[model samples]
Target: MTTKFGFTLMSIQEFETWIDARQLARTVLTIQEHHTYSPAYTQFNGSNHFALQQGMKNYHVNANGWSDIGQHFTTFPDGTIMTGRSLEKSPACVVGQNANAICIENLGNFDSGKDAMTPAHRDTIIRITAKLCKRFRLPVNTNSIVYHHWFDLSTGERNNGTKNNKTCPGTSFFGGNKVADCVANFLPLVTQAGAPAAPVISASAVLKYVSVTASSLNIRTKPNASSPKATDRDAAALGAILRVYKETNGWYKISGSQEHWVLGKYTTDVKRATVKADTLNARSGPGTTFQKLGSYTKGQELFIVKEQNGWCKVNMDDRWVSKDYLVFA
Candidate 1:
């Protein structure tokens, strides 16, 4: 195994072993499959793994204004896997559907008239996905493993290519990028490779929403301070709403399918509310004497973190607004 730009480049076998041994602290409900349409097969020279990875990172950071590469991992035509973003944080892929997702970008255009998929690369994609499903206890299905073509290019809705969408993962990726194509061709291979699917948990029905009150809150693998941190450097950003499935001691399990937990002390049960005032001042403190942070227009929705002295704290930071200007849902 070799490391480049803080990313680990590993063989398929090494990746399988490494992922299997890892104890993921964050919850991952979906695995996204994408194709790098720009950096076609010709860009890879077998030994330029680090260079290519760095180039992509630089583009993502400089052009896209993202902190790092969007995808969690990239698969090469030579059957190599290079890590990208940290698994703890949400990926930048798929816009609004990034939360709780692990994105995999296969290096090379897989369109029918574009780069032809190699046998080694094809086998590696199948097995690596299977290994991830097995290790993460994810079911091999359309909902669990998704294609970029399935979502809307603008709104990020799961339209399944019925409307405006990019032919990502390709027009002929694994036969096709449609949901039916995945069900018929791709999922069967993954199921065969990683047999006996893990049991699915039905915990979504019991989840309750809560808003983070602290500027940044830590997520843990277990509901205790001794447990390892589930997220990367920064905590869950202020105003981030998380769904809680279970509560123990004072910690809440934030993930329905994974053992991700966060402290309840820094969170508050919130209700969605809309701004009633045409232009309301967002303050740094609860009183009118506090500095103004910003302003919200009428009908703008925000989560009410807490209320103090007729002022409602609207975000995880010190941003507050008068409760008189909020219409709770």
Candidate 2:
């Protein structure tokens, strides 16, 4: 690995090995494809990986006011991989979709009639994407592997290359940046590169709701401490409600479009219920004799951790309320 500006540049094989050994603490669901629009192909000298990386970092940090370079990795025309932002943090790529994502910024602009993609770069991109899919157990599809062109540039909503979107990965990236283009020209190669089939969650698996008890909990790509992290701050936070799909070895797999697992030890499994009363007191204990912690609005979602004597524990903490004011979900 070549280190510069505290970032490591690696060959595809090295990257594969490095990522294989990492243990992340967040959940990641999507892989975003983007092109460095400004730098273009001519800026690269084929060996200035460090210089280019530092330049991008300066821009992202100073101009954009981001904590670091926006993407997790950068792919060069020669197929070298340069690490950027922390994999543990969410990328500042697509606005609303940055949660649970890993972003890749290709070195050259790829718009139609722009820089021609080199054979090495094309092969590397495909291989790296496939490797990530296999490592994270993500299915090769439009949802799991996404293009920046699919979102609105302003509002950051998924519009499928419709109104107000930038041609990001680019207008000519892999035949086109639309969802149909991915299905036709991109996903097949990713599948051929050996993306594993998605695991099927059985109906027999009991579904449970839970709230994060830790100040910041790690959402993993798999149900173990050795797995890479998946979700960043956008998707997970203290008191955030998460749906548990399955359980294994004290880890709970969260219900979502992707495979995200969190340690059950850091979360409190609860029943989802809404408030029935216009205003109900949240107490320090299960009975009315307990101190009033606060009051909740009607229709507010409450996590019922434990039920007792017509009262429900609203959180992992000792907050409770009468069961009569709650409508169990």
Candidate 3:
């Protein structure tokens, strides 16, 4: 149950620390540092302020605050990479399960009617993603990475329709193919046989464009480092425009921002995207489940270590779990 990024297999705790830290060394800035407001923020009419604050508080509680175990690892917008929960710990970012995946918080209101993210933000996310892919051995492609919306438990209603009526990451974020594209861009860097080919972008090429339907994306600079120089960047607000430049080893080196990288799995490309349940309660038997065994829910993105019949055998929270409990989005 582990997610490989570069040569590293970040445990749940390590991943959580990364989110709280907001390691920007691997991030890029989409919008310039001094911007007025984010379009996505304005569009989200829900409790965006409450959401952000609550998310931050929750992250702290699960990883930093009372828990002191660090749950998430990083936060976008300010581009600061703080450390959070350990690989063995769990987080509260998501409902029901988070024992495996590290939840990252991107500042801004995603539910708002407008898009709040910028290209620079994407660049940062791509590079960080690329590095993680190489470290954990997870596929850098979009197929493995997923959005908050896409993460659904087996007990919850299908397609994110649940009786609890929870709204995570918001509809604006992780709405469409954007998460896929992010993973796609980063996968190449890790999968490349050797050094990646030079960026195939032209200076005259217009900035590639994608809508930041979500409130935020995890942006990085070098993919695996933590430095203020690399972390410095304005948050990607809603409705902000961005341009794509070139793809590198498991990363999308953006053109709009100085030089930023985003994880390949979070983009719109046609990488295989699927949603899986966190450590599903395993039973000695069946029917409403039998005895509850240990559980896992590690890694932001996981590689399909193995799969079979209606089930996919995958690493759980950097460990192994039963495939029968898994379900795709």
lDDT of 3: 0.37
lDDT of 3 by residue, 148-232 (tens): 4433443221133233333434444433223343335434543453212222333345333332323554456654335222345
Task: Write model 2 residue lDDT over 110-207, tens digit each, in one string.
Answer: 99999899998998899889888877667787767889888777545466777888888988899998989988998898888777656334343447
Could you give me the TM-score of model 1 versus the true structure? 0.69
How good is model 3 by TM-score? 0.38
After superposing candidate 1 on the true structure, give the runs of residues whose Cα lies further than 4 Å from its correct spot. 195-262, 267-329
lDDT (tens digit, per residue) of candidate 1 on 121-185: 99889988888887666788776788988777765656678777889899888999998899899
True-vs-predicted CA distance for residue 36, candidate 3, Å? 20
Model 1, position 245, has a per-residue lDDT of 84
Report the poorest 10 consecutive residues by lDDT, candidate 3.
27-36
The lDDT-based order of candidates, best leading, equals 1, 2, 3
Prediction 1 global C-alpha lDDT: 0.78
Q: Of 1 and 3, which scores higher on TM-score?
A: 1
